[model samples]
Target: MSHTATPPPAMPPKLAEIVDEFASAPRDVVLEMLLEYSDAVPPLPETMTDRAGMEQVPECQTAFFLRVEVAADRTVTTWFDCPPEAPTTRAFAGILAEGLTGAGADQVLAVPDDLYQRMGLAQAISPLRVRGGTAILARLKRQVREQIG
Candidate 1:
């Protein structure tokens, strides 16, 4: 007798609610939901800047690097994880550019809780976190490219 493989469990309903909302929603709707989810997911680093100038940056500031492994039924699971970090104007822009071009993400964003919490908005973040986010983003981008290719 032949046996079929059983699939993994789907994402939790609560988490699915959040991910599906973003996955299927319009850009503005996704952004709004992401903000709400980010807020509730704290002890988040509130130290990130509140400056309106930061808005000039692209949407990539909020995207977390992920390796999404989709099942036959289209359920998604992360095959790999990278910590949240996006620091510096130049590095942030590069992340958006590379992530978009490489990952096919029209927009890329990040959650810099670790960096922001450590640096706080008043005090500048340590050079380490700043550099770390850049490095991690670069590494994740490369990984995505290699896998896709």
Candidate 2:
């Protein structure tokens, strides 16, 4: 079946391009991209290396944690912690971190809630995993709102 992906919401140019890239790739290709992203997630900064600053996402079956920092100019920096065994969950973190990191708080907040659906991962990953991915984004946006407002 053919799927139509919605346009990305206002965001950084790089982030919007990443979303579009996933949306345009084949389902199997999307899965490959996810794996590639998982490897690309960067090490947490010294300030967040202590785990105390990171919030765990209980919605994911895996023990996933993340933190987002906003600069005076509203640019964002995100960090994620996840096990090697939980590549799928970690991929969500990597994708978010790679895609949205350095975006303005307003841009991150404007991202579409269903952006993950456009990745075409539903055919490869479980619904629960997909929900977890969405939850991660929701949490990111929540933290951004709380910090900047």
Candidate 3:
């Protein structure tokens, strides 16, 4: 069953690798990969460590806070505040931060809403968790638009 809203286009190189790697992995290994991504989520920068500076995602069961910035040159950077205990939430944050970092504001905006469907994670993770992935992207793009527009 196709979960993508449209034919998925080629993503940024780093993102494409992460998605493609998961798409081909067996169900048993998907969780392992997600845990790896959770580990890859860098610690929150000292400036953004405070909850007030970051926006919390109500859609997520865990406390997932994020900040998306578009620089004067239009380079996008994303940050996350998810705990180590919440691997699933942290994995989603990590994926977004890794995928969207260095991307242009327009590129980040062009990303589809139902991206997790294309990532082949639905079978391994809960529907709510997958939706949280899309929500993170949506919120990040919104923040980017607010910053650069």
Candidate 4:
């Protein structure tokens, strides 16, 4: 019998590109790209600086918090808080924040839950770390759903 591998679900364009990029990159390049993304995670907005309203992702080894807002037009904006010492977790936040922000809620909702797996991060980072990234995406998506409702 012959079987075909299932394709990943459709994702926001920017996120899809990031996943494709990491999927093809070498292990060293993946780690390098992750560090670059770590620097790309924008600082929380002035309103969110206190992080009082943010939800924590307990799966992360480091302290990580996030919030998602969906505009009337359904554009999604994400905020992530992660320590500079945890580059891997911050990179995951950067990827989601940069890629999902400005995207439509439907597009953001369409993103696969196992996005880190598609990004091939398990090859470059520890499985535990990868799980944190997965949890981040899950929480981000849940917040988006809550906002849109």
Candidate 5:
């Protein structure tokens, strides 16, 4: 009897895009890459008692993964690899904040939750799909830093 071989699962378009963007970046850049990618397409945050474990919520999705290993005083380094179906506006801030804390960052560099909510534009932060390149993601991060910080 002949058996047909099954094809491997396809990589999420968003993930492939993210890997291409920062595959060769430095640790900090990689952290930024992850945050940007996740903010664009965040995997759901996992729930847990411990903060670190709670951090796993987003990373567990087929969309993203976080790798943090650095040596710097009060330096935050968080990396997230997200699927293609995540939101990108207000959620991005929360995702980034959780990632920063999860990765041992002292604090997040984005806007505060209360302030963002006060603006009444939370729902607009829909998840972004990585279609063109990571440059867009990088640019968005810059904007977020400027507006929030």
Candidate 6:
């Protein structure tokens, strides 16, 4: 018998592009791209300097906090706090921040929960790190739902 793998659900355009890139990239290139994204993680705005309002994702091996804001128009913006030492976690945050920010709440919520799996990150990074990324997506989506309600 022969079987075919099912494609992942459609994602937001930017995120889908990122996933497609990683899915086809060599392992070394994946790591390099992740590092590039790590550097791309945006700085927290002045109002979020305290980070008291952010939620922590204990699933991450490092200390990581994130906040998701949905504008009155239902556009989403994400902020993340992770030590520079934790490049992988920072890369995950950067991916979400860049891909999901400016997306509609419905679009953000429609994102598949197994986003990291689709990116093929486990082939380049540890499963634990991939798990952390998954948790980050979950938290971001939860916040989006809360904001919309």
lDDT of 6 by residue, 48-85 (tens): 88896999999999999999889989888888999999
Runs with alpha carbons beyond 4 Å of true place in candidate 6: 1-10
TM-score of 6: 0.90
Each model's C-alpha lDDT? 0.33, 0.84, 0.81, 0.87, 0.35, 0.87
Off by over 4 Å in 1: 42-149
What is candidate 1's CA lDDT for residue 146? 48
lDDT of 3 by residue, 14-46 (tens): 776777888888889888988788877878777
TM-scores for every candidate against the unseen true structure = 0.28, 0.88, 0.87, 0.91, 0.28, 0.90
lDDT of 2 by residue, 54-143 (tens): 889899999888888888999888888998898899888888887886789988998888878876776678999999999888998899
lDDT for each residue of candidate 4 in 1-149, tens digit (9 for 90 to 100):
99998764457889889989999998788999988899889998898889978999999999999988888998888888999999889999888877876798888889988888888888888999989998888888888888888
Please provide the root mean square deviation of candidate 5 (C-alpha atoms, Å): 18.1
Stretches of model 4 off by over 4 angstroms after superposition: 1-9
In the range 1-149, model 5's lDDT, one tens digit per residue, is 99999764333333233334444455455444444534543333453112342122232223333333333453444344434554332234334434344322222323233332222222222222222122222433343344333
Cα displacement (angstroms), candidate 2, residue 133, comes to 0.5
TM-score of 4: 0.91
Q: Tens digit of lDDT per residue, candidate 1, span 47-88?
A: 332331111212234443333333344332222222234224
Residue 111 of model 4: what lDDT? 93
Question: Clashes in model 6: which pairs?
Answer: none
Error of 6 at 74 (Å): 0.6
94 in model 4: Cα distance from truth in Å?
0.8
RMSD of each: 15.4, 6.7, 6.1, 5.0, 18.1, 5.8
The candidate that achieves the highest TM-score relative to the unseen native structure: 4
- Minimum summed lDDT over a 10-residue window in model 3 is located at 4-13
State the displacement of the C-alpha of residue 112, model 1, in Å, after optimal TM-score superposition: 20
